[model samples]
Target: MTGTPRRFLVTATPPTTNGDLHVGHLSGPYLGADVFSRAQRMLGHTALYASGGDDHQTYVVTTAQRLGVDPVELAARCNREITGTLELADIDIDAFTRPDDVYRDEVREFFAGLYSAGRLVRRTWTFPYCAETDRYLLEAFATGYCPECLVGTCGAICENCGHPNDAGSLLFAESAGAQEGSTTEPRDVEILVLPLEEYREQFTEFYRRRRATMRPHVLRFVDEMLSRPLPDFPVSYPAHWGIPVGIEGFDGQVINVWAEMLPGLRHMAEAARVRRSPRTPAGVWAADSGFELVQFLGYDNTFYFSFAHLGLALAHGGLVEPTAIVTNEFYHLNGSKFSTSRRHLIWARDLVGKYGPDNVRFHLGLSNPEHQPADFTEAGFLETVRTRLHEPLQALATALAPHTGQPVTVRPETEALLDRYRDRMRRAYTLETFSVRQATETTANLLALLAARAAGDPGLAVAGLRVLGAQAAPLVPGLAAVIESRYAAATPGTVPELADLLPVTV
Candidate 1:
């Protein structure tokens, strides 16, 4: 364990409330953040993992319309489903917040402060207007080829190249809700925009300090974005389905959902703090709070978390910027990206229900898509669980079944082995080079080694099992709990009872 303990307010990118979470979603920020936070706690630190449903995204409005339901009702239901799915997947989020009156007030105050400080500028921008839908084609309401990569993509951000496209900037833009061949006409309107070019120097200095630690792919994306003139990020949009901007001369506009992200995170953090300590006042986001911010997100959201959000925090005085940003690549299913619109994915709840949470978490962790796109196949998952986890665990249990209730003293050799494994885990869980896949592999290797020595050196095996239980707690929490309970008396350097054998299956 580290000699000094640190405090961390770890956050995952909030999932949009348009639909239920899928395995692809769980495999990215949610699972990664949970494991990282848990590992930090294991190292004797204070790590509060928090996130919530993105209830104000345009996707929610479009999905509600498609389903013939009220937008508020749909968002609420989806939020509940998302919270339940996270719980089922064993993601222990401290605060799963929903957009309430308090949230809205906080977001409004944050935006108003930025505007008053001259960080935001009012300008006339052109946006595509769909006559058929009688709405401006922005965000989820629009679809076109990205301006940079020329890949077919939705508005706002391109998942392929990690670039942002302003409304009406997408090539061959068309209304997503309109009939085939339906086109949108350009309409100019006054709105608030953040000219990112103005803060180029600040962003450059910030990224210069982070170059060594940030992921290569993420750094490449940032460098590519900084190579050109930064685009104007719209802060407000003309709409009626979201939180109203409430700024003068923008009566009909609402705050852009992307722009609301940083403030929303602050709100969630404050909420978490209040729950942890009732007397603690708000403003835990202050830079002097001593809580290092660590953000976990996917490659598609690198721009928002690393750049856009950083700009917002800097512009807002006294707010803390993220100290570390962890990103994962796309997790695919059957060689294709999981898409709710295409309905080509496995629901997280279904998998957890069928295979159990620990089994599912173990598979996802072993195959975590950290650097490149990783595919999820049922056959591959089943094979990994059977060979890598279940078989070895069962073998060890069988060999030690006869030794149940027997007392054994841990050996010096066992301490050295445990120390080596602990070192591996410390490396794997390091914030700068964190890897769930590596951590999972270390746990599996320890289990295999223990299984091999179960019969010959039962004392060493039991002691090693104790080490494995503690090490695996962060990755496979449910399994670790079971292991610890069964081997409760198998403490290192002491003669203790083995109690009972491991479960037949996990």
Candidate 2:
């Protein structure tokens, strides 16, 4: 282990207050951040994991209206559901602050400060107005019939026809689920804009520097953003649904989610400071904080999370900058994007209800979609549960249980094997590389080796099992107790050879 552990600020926004979290949510930044935070704690580091419910978006208000309840009540109900779901999945968030409640003033200051400094500008742009919502549609809701292929779908671009259309170019639906009887409307609204053009050269340099210093996938994203046409749209909306802009003239307007949402990062930074121990490292609060801020998110949020938000946060704030933005591409389910509307996604509740949190945790670690789109199939779920969680760990526990019959000597080779596992885990957790496949592969190889070792040599196998049973005891205390009770009276398995499990890679 390293001499001293590094402090971390791990932050992610909870799913929309109106939406239920699915497997995609589990496998995305939230899961990744949870794994990273847990690993940091395991390594004896101070890691602050902060998350908050997003209750200010138009979707939340519209969803609430459809249910014939106030948006605040609906947001509260959904927040409760979200908290329950995450807790059941063992997502132990250190702090769960609601954006609308605890972070509103912070977000307001963020907007006003930027605007007063001339960093924020205003512009007019066309947006899709939903009669049902009585508000303009955000990018997430706007969809149309494909003028090319004529397939009406629920995406900014048509999936069936593969064509792109603006709100005026196609027939508008009242709600996302709006049928033929759905109401439609178009309204022009004035919105405040964040002028990214002024910072083009600065962003180019910042992004290029980030690309040069970061992992390859992160670098690729930097290159993509640098080459894309700059978005010159208003960062604030004339709608009453989001965090209100504090500018004197923009009372009714709310800072759009993109520009306003990143204040959540700073809120977490301050919260971490408040939560940190007195002896905590000074860099955690230093103006030029050396600690990296790694943001995890899905591919759909790449533009905002990967580039735009990072740039905005760095440009607007003074404390810490986003060092590594670790965004996964996506976790697709059933050959399509995991959608709450389509019911194609697996909710965390269902999985947690069936098995347990630890089991689900193992699956999340094994199936992290850090790179390209990864599939989450029922077969994959069953296989991971059986092989990775149930069978292998159970086998190790059983093999080690009987070895404690006496004060057994710790074998040097066995200790070395445990050290190897520790080192691999440390690397995977802190190295912050984009190669999750490699991490899982290494974990698999180690587990397979342990299983084979348990099957083979008596003395070394027993000692190895004992060490694993010891190390994992703290993390999974219940499983540890079970292992100690059952295996302490038993004996090690007798396979012909020990070399089968402990292979020399060199």
Candidate 3:
């Protein structure tokens, strides 16, 4: 709310060290965070963009074994692939810190602090056993065929059926050899646990209070996830590829994936602490510190991220709390879940090469996956580019070509339109509740108006257009520059190519 842009810690999972980012990953979580981060910077907020490769667990090791490569070597290769993918998609994070990043020390300290506070419990838990690897599988690598949707990788619960199951209930076939329902050996593993029941009353109170202030759609979700009793989290895993458990007694076990994710906030907080200066923005570290911490995640990860924050609060008496969390449902492509194994993903690299980043960004931004699954079609892509980014932006630039050097005066209509856009963007953070439908609709309407206005008064619209470019440039630097350059070229006889502007759209 301060005129000074509040310091924000924007975070997302670092791509797995094995492959490039797929359309589902981009559309659901990364796309929204990218949009929000870029927009925030345009609004003058000091935001530290942080992300890293999820290099731990059995999946990485199994993939390595399948490829006949060392696990560490495989992870490195995957990390590079993901980083390159993100860069290609125009996701310019400030620090793409990997698991090996210096932040691990902070993570260990954070864990140690929690343990010192009597918040961590050591417990022997039953985990999915993979006889092939002769090791216990973290939920990250565990999958079961959904009895309802009949999809594999349903893990401990069948989301399609909304039915929960214990590890013993699901069948585990070999990775490359086995028949369905064939019984495999099971392994017992020790893992640390974080009890969230301690804060049930606190979460209930917090939700009740937050409900009064948040939009109805958001409260409905909070209620659904909170309706059940909180579960205990296994903080450590038996896998050799992840962060080692900090507990003194839990040797040979890596921290669980859920535990791996909890450190992102603290990592972000430490990043902010390092960047803090005399003019440092507030709310970067402290829970009640007033800074907003927004997380963009998929529906599958809801229970983990949702309670992770509350559990963190319960662990630490007075730490900073997550200000807002945006979780989206799955993204379907041509009526099926986008899958890499089946070559079903609309690769970000391929799409960017074809239509450009700006178009991809615009399309995903418009067809947001915040509320429910959103479809991405070839026709829809072309329509968005033709109507939204290419025509209107070019037309606006063309109209303003004659007035570049003059002390430009914005027409009333242009001023009013830009003013409305500014006002809408002013509320972007407020709409952080993961209702992508609402946010996308609101953003699309503004963008449509922006496109129309640009085409309406090319000459007199220079100042207004440049102002818009400046506001958005912070987020999409390349696109903003493209807009500014094209507008400048509009002087008298010069006009930038429409194709050149397309790159910014991705």
Candidate 4:
């Protein structure tokens, strides 16, 4: 926080390989992360952006069963889809490794390291189980009235009120494949738990010190949890398809997916090292190397990424503590929470094909839902592209085409505008704050302003639009690279045409 870090790690929420992504997913974390990391690199920082597919989730298994395919096949396909979608959207990602290969061993080692270090608690807990299935219920199969919200709920967390309920507390069990009113009884189970209560004091200190700068909703959630007794977090499930923790007695128990993610970051780093020139020094990405660490995530996941993941990292003894936790509120689609399970969402691949990455990214970047749930309606999307983006792209082209090789002086007002753009760019980037919405909007508004003034003063237009290319290089790198290429041909003071440089159709 005091000085520019020697190394920076920018990570988005690791996506599960259960489904394709929607704009809501991108807008929340990935888009901002991509923009920030790109900007950080542009600023001459040694930044590595890496993420991996979350392949061994209970949700993946559930989805696999519904689709009548092997979980492994499902995970593989979904991982490809996710990586492809990100690539097609021109989202910069260095390493997106699957967990099925060399990564699995490292994940188990991380589990062993934490368990041996006394960070994990092995204990027995009871949960509802149907005798007919000969297995304990875990997620949707374990449906019951949520004690926290008094509403029908499934899984560990209550959507209505973000509380991860104890397995023994859910009421009116509805086991998977069981008929209505079927008698489901309690079954005692042993599992590994991350004792958050024990880590509460340290975590509380960390949270309180950084509370003022954290996202409003996330800070409130961590505040509420720490104010009360921090609950014991579970880290083991009976899922047969995940990494076996190899604990002394818990033979078949697998490490929880959430637990795997914390270490998965390290594995991703290791994999990423191979791809970098001269390679990253061993252990640099694994532990606390005195460099700043940042994690971007959505609203529902703040507790885990902030508290649980941080606890795991610290407990392992030397992983860099998260200096900044950038949390986004949500992106609502048609006033409803965009959900993949319900299939009420726009597919990322389809959106990319239709509008092109820059066009679609413009909508998300401009309307990025940071502190509040930003709505993504079809009508609003078209209007924004028409009024905000398309015109600026067109105007820059027309204004710069004539002055392509001409040098001119910029007015004081236009210079002031450029300064404002740089200030906004600073705030919207990695080191200060990961506010992509603000960055996109500021740049777009400035471009529009320049477009209007272009007719009267072509010098200002040329200078302003040229600067716009520089400022926008982080957010839309693919498109910005094209813009920068055209600007490169300009004779020092000349401008880059938006049309000739940019291949953005419509």
Best by TM-score: 1
Relative to the true structure, candidate 4 has a C-alpha RMSD (angstroms) of 2.3
lDDT of 4 by residue, 80-106 (tens): 999999999888877788886578788
Runs in model 1 with CA error above 4 Å?
Answer: 277-281, 489-506
Q: Candidate 2 versus the native: TM-score? A: 0.81
CA-RMSD of model 2:
6.0
Clashing pairs in 1: none
Query: What is the lDDT, from 0 to 100, of the residue 264 in candidate 4?
Result: 87
Model 1, 371-412: lDDT tens digits are: 999999999998898888888777777777787666666678
What ranking of all candidate models by TM-score puts the best one first? 1, 4, 3, 2
Residue range 154-242, candidate 2, lDDT tens digits = 43334333233444555643345445566656566566766655667877777666763255566665565467555553567667777
lDDT of each candidate versus the true structure: 0.85, 0.62, 0.62, 0.76
User: TM-scores of the models, in the given order?
Assistant: 0.96, 0.81, 0.82, 0.93
Query: What TM-score should be assigned to candidate 1?
Result: 0.96
Cα lDDT of candidate 4 equals 0.76
Which runs in model 2 stand beyond 4 Å of their true positions?
Answer: 65-68, 100-102, 128-133, 145-189, 212-218, 276-286, 317-319, 397-402, 434-440, 466-506
